[model samples]
Target: MNHGQTAPEDRARPLSVVLAGGGTAGHISPMIAIADAVRRSRPDARITMVGTPSGMETRLVPAAGYALETIDRVPMPRRLSADLAKLPGRFSRAVRQAAEIIRAAEADVVVGVGGYVCTPMYAAARRLRVPIVIHEANARPGLANRVGRALGGSVAVAFASTPLGGADHVGMPMRREISQLDRAGRRAEARAALGADPQERLIVVTGGSSGAASINRAVAEFASSGRAAEAGVRLIHITGRGKEVLDPAGSPLSAPGYAQRDYVDGMETAYAAADLLVARSGAGTVSELAATGTPAVLVPLPHGNGEQALNAHDLVSAGGAILVPDDEFTADFLAQTVAPLARDEDRLAEMSRAALTSGVRDADEQMAARVIAAAEAGRGEGRSRA
Candidate 1:
């Protein structure tokens, strides 16, 4: 039960880790990336993921080749209501379920990437006296990560200015496809993969895993307007599953210079191929754009705690991207601003350079290192208590 060993051979067994996060691609993607990093560094390490049964993680975690454990979701109510009254009972049950999962996994460290599943995971890890490592992907910390931090979890943030105290700026952990992409070198191939002519100015639009209605309306209208075709711009629109745009005839949308997809599996190709990306400014999207040096027109999700806007601040301030409010990001803006900007090679190149200047491409490894260290420290503390 020695806790302070640097080498694997000094320990009785390989490290056992449990990662908790889900509900969206933002949380799950980073969690998976960190797990991959940890596995690469320590192939013998055992990794398990904990998420709510109904979260995207059920499909994503298994698809990523990790073991997954599910617990009932217990979202904290924001206001004084019936749901708020039931919170304690739900939270307690979830915590008990989480504790069983952690104990069964024999987790050395519990890593969380803020989501609905994390609060209970944090509570469970604390109860087990296991070290908790948290990755806060938003500039405005979520309630779960805030609670984890207050419980003395080692906190890391995607944004340097995140409000969490004593948090390290680790950027966002992303899949290697994006993090290691040489955008300039792979541009032609990536464009080809997306069926875009190498010379065509490509604008890639996405509202993340779940499509944004405002963005869909604006972009779809712009696409149907035929301006993009007239200007020789090619567009790839990922409308999210079941959120497809429709025409006035009440049929699926079809427009010149527009390729609509319900989803795209590997976004790195899109990042590489896109001359300009039009997307919501989630922390993950912002980090990917910066990492890949992709110029962008960011439309923050109009709702939420204003975090999406804050997430885009650094890149926008650095001249890597343009931020448009949801209300203002209209088809007119696309035609007037984004379409013209897409054709401006000089401006796009300059923006790409600015993006690269602020990019951090090694966050997965950085977070993995933090998790490993926390695991060792936790083990040492266990030895001391024993």
Candidate 2:
């Protein structure tokens, strides 16, 4: 609870929440969704974000209208090359800075998502006696979240298949915009808002929030070739603010049948507009696609033991979507895979059902309520003013 603020339920106290984690949208998006959920239940809950300056969260968190406190930190390299000499010093500074940030937030609870920076971030919160919670988005635990669980209230997760070691499954926190799609008879209007053509199969492409260079390259190549245009597909591509150019002016895919934006403002409408979706298999994307029942072709990031591949395979094995490895991606393959699927109304319908089956629609509310319960339960104590 924040100083002298009372909870509406009992007029007793108001809670403050501190979220620690984010390097990618996969990590940061969930935190934002959870914060929104927390706000809905307890409007008085104050929220702040703590993140390493090295990642996109530094830009994204502030962009979402939240203040970001920066700490100098990086994740441990997966391989131990000789350059690890900087680890100890950097880790020490990050912990100290993170601890200071916690003290400043006057936070009642600290939530850790993903990323190596989480180690020091949660360490500060734990040592400061703030209630801690971890939200794990993957079906499998990341090494950081696995270790951080000891310091958490419960491991909130997106997928039912995730291994959380007896932790409660609070589902993935989806952006509130997605839950709006649950309203009756909004699909066609939502689709029209994104400017879908009445005669063509609407296809939306995203390379994750920061943009997938490989996916972007592939889509740009495909879009430039006029193949998508020939196939009568309307395209909406999110560039994630990395590249300035999407295609040449005279390119075949550069026609009025397409709209390209660096950042997506109406993601819900994009989902509503898309019949066949092409995207990265980030947990947040996977959950969003599932919730919106949008059929997708998932291209997992090929590096790092196939984390994204594993996620895509989970959906594929359950008949939700197709998994195309990055190495297998090309302009021709993308056109052949996406174009036909877009035209096949029955396939789109089936895939949408499969995707819906994979969704945890109420994840945000479940996670928020759980975290708030813990925060309330732990609120008998207060932070030391020292």
Among these predictions, the greatest lDDT belongs to 1
List residue ranges in candidate 2 displaced over 4 A. Answer: 1-11, 77-86, 104-106, 182-194, 213-226, 229-232, 239-263, 380-386
The deviation in Å at residue 45 for candidate 2 is 1.8
| Pairs with steric clashes in candidate 2 | 6-13, 7-13, 158-172
lDDT of each: 0.90, 0.75
Estimated TM-score for each candidate: 0.93, 0.83
Model 1 lDDT per residue over 120-221, tens place: 999988888889999999888999999999988999999887888999998999999899999989999888888889988999999888888899988888
Q: Report the lDDT of model 2 for residue 256.
A: 49
TM-score, structure 1 vs. true: 0.93
lDDT of candidate model 2 versus the reference: 0.75
Candidate with the greatest TM-score versus the true structure: 1
